[model samples]
Target: MWQIFSRFLALGLISFGGPAAHIGYFRKAFVDDLQWLDSKQYASFVALSQFMPGPGSSQVGFAIGYHKGGVLGGLAAFLGFTLPSFLLLFLFAVTSAQWLEISAVQGIIHGLKLLAVVVVADATLSMFTQFCQRKTAKMLMATTAVAIILMPSMLMQIAVLVMAAIIGGILLTRGENITPENPPITLNYSWLALFILCLASSLYFIGQDDTIGQIFAQFFQVGSLVFGGGHVVLPLLEASVGDYITPDRFLTGYALAQAIPGPMFTLATFLGADLWLESPILGAIVATIAIFLPGFLLMLVGLKSWHTISQRPHIAGVLAGVNAAVVGLLFAALYQPVFTSAVIMPLDMALVIIGFSLLKVFKPGIVWLVMGFAATGALLTLI
Candidate 1:
């Protein structure tokens, strides 16, 4: 527990660049350095997290901790990674807005954002090779990527994934067997059933007039429904609470969150603090937990049955499609927000190529990469 907490805490503190960047940082630390999980194991967790709704990067972190320390470890990882952003977002809520406008802070953030660009690119390359090995799988990966770039919406993502599954079922059904890594989760069906029940109950009553209940339901619904990942939270949040939250506040929280670490879903912390004036702290706490609850529960439930379901040939084929689509989805993300957003200038492009080349040659730990890029970015501010 201590190990999980401490490691993730360091990650949370230095972490920036959002979900795609988080995955790169996490893979370097947990899989490459710690040997807590192998690439295949980590990929399984990533696949599942992306497959389901909720915060993509956070859920992946939770699964790693779950793999290491069971339930307690999962919670430990969540707290450790989220604490940095949670506290920072909360502070952003209470403090004057001008604090974030400082030049040094902006320089650091820009550097970290560039670091995210490198990290995400690295992760994308790794996942592409691992997940899209077959010809059909490769084709599906390309198709999915193009489709997403063309239409990057939550509903479109869901449709693409569903179509991928169907294609995999038809084209790639007979393939090699994937050996099981760890045994099934011991949490069992009773807990999973209860989780589903609560999720369903929350959705059923989301229209309630009560303030807290409404808040919980709104977040829970978003957690349950979102398909793409943390970045997709913007539109859903707007639609869910457009009338309640002012455009300025919503945009403010989103903008400030970009400069911080951990999952973008921590936007809930800011939204909660901003929306519920009487109890800002309570709102932050409740909204954070509520938004993340459904996804966590789904991981517990889904991972338990993954072994049994995956063994069948037909199911495995569908998973192949799903995995391919996951890659495509990530590939699309790497371009839009990850690549296009961060790589603006000629220097930015040069930095990314240099970072990638360094990673390929030395294979240094992510800490070195993060620090190096951050320093480089900060220094570039002078020029």
Candidate 2:
């Protein structure tokens, strides 16, 4: 349990760039280094995460922990991985925003964003080699990437994955007879019931005068409804909160969440704190839990079954197609938000090349890489 927590905790502190980058970091740490699971198993988890509605990358981490040590391990992974970002956003909520404006801080954020580009690019390439070996699969990946890059939306993402699955089910399964191996299969329906109950409860309590209840209800609904990634929750949250949080404050939290490590859902932590002035910390805690609860509950419902069903021949082909599309999703994300935002100058590109080379060749510790990039970013500001 401690091992699970410690591993994910180490990741939470440095897993920046958003969901795509978090997936990359998880691949390197769990799949590449610790051998917690093989590449296919990790990819299976990633593929499953897309179909579910919560924080995508965090769900993958939780699934990995659950695979390793069951329910307690999953909780440990969530707490460990989310703790750093939770604390940071909570502090950001109560503190002055002036610190965010510091030149050194700006430089560090720039550096980390650049690091994200390098990390994501590497993951995209690695997954491409593993999942897109066949010509059809490669074309699926390329088309998915191009389509997403051309017209990126949650709807488009879902459609692409679904289409890929149908195509793979028909095309990729010929002469492929390997049986899928899954961990002990245990279907738990109680979790689905609990998720439904929570959603119902949120609707009921949302009309009440209790501020904390309202906070919980709003975020819980947002968690339940938003699909694809954490960024999707932003607008839902903004609309749900009504006038309780000003647009400026909400955008500030969004920006900070983007600039910080960990899940962007921690934006809920910030908003919860801002919502309830009486006991801001309590608000933060409740909001964070509320926003994250639905996805985990739904995951618990499906985790075992998804693994079991995925091992079948036809379903395996479906997953094959979905996995290929997922690589493309990562590829598209790397260019738009990850690459475009970070690589603003030739110097940034040069640094990315250096960092990518080091990652591939020397393979330094992630902690050291984070520190070095952060330091370089700050120094660049001074220069």
Name the runs in model 2 displaced over 4 angstroms.
1-77, 92-96, 174-186, 193-295, 303-307
Q: How do the residues 155-265 of candidate 1 rate in per-residue lDDT, one tens digit apiece?
A: 676688789889998898885555444344344676579677877777676777557877887788777765546555655675567678765556557655766778889
- TM-score of candidate 2 on Cα atoms, chains taken together: 0.67
Evaluate residue 100 in candidate 1 and report its C-alpha lDDT on the 0 to 100 scale.
51
Residue-level lDDT tens digits of model 2 in 63-115: 99998999999999999999999999899888846676899987876787777
Query: Scored by Cα lDDT, where does model 1 land?
Result: 0.77
Error of 2 at 281 (Å): 5.3
Give the best candidate by lDDT. 2
lDDT of each: 0.77, 0.80
**Pairs of residues at least 3 apart in sequence or in different chains that clash in candidate 1:** none
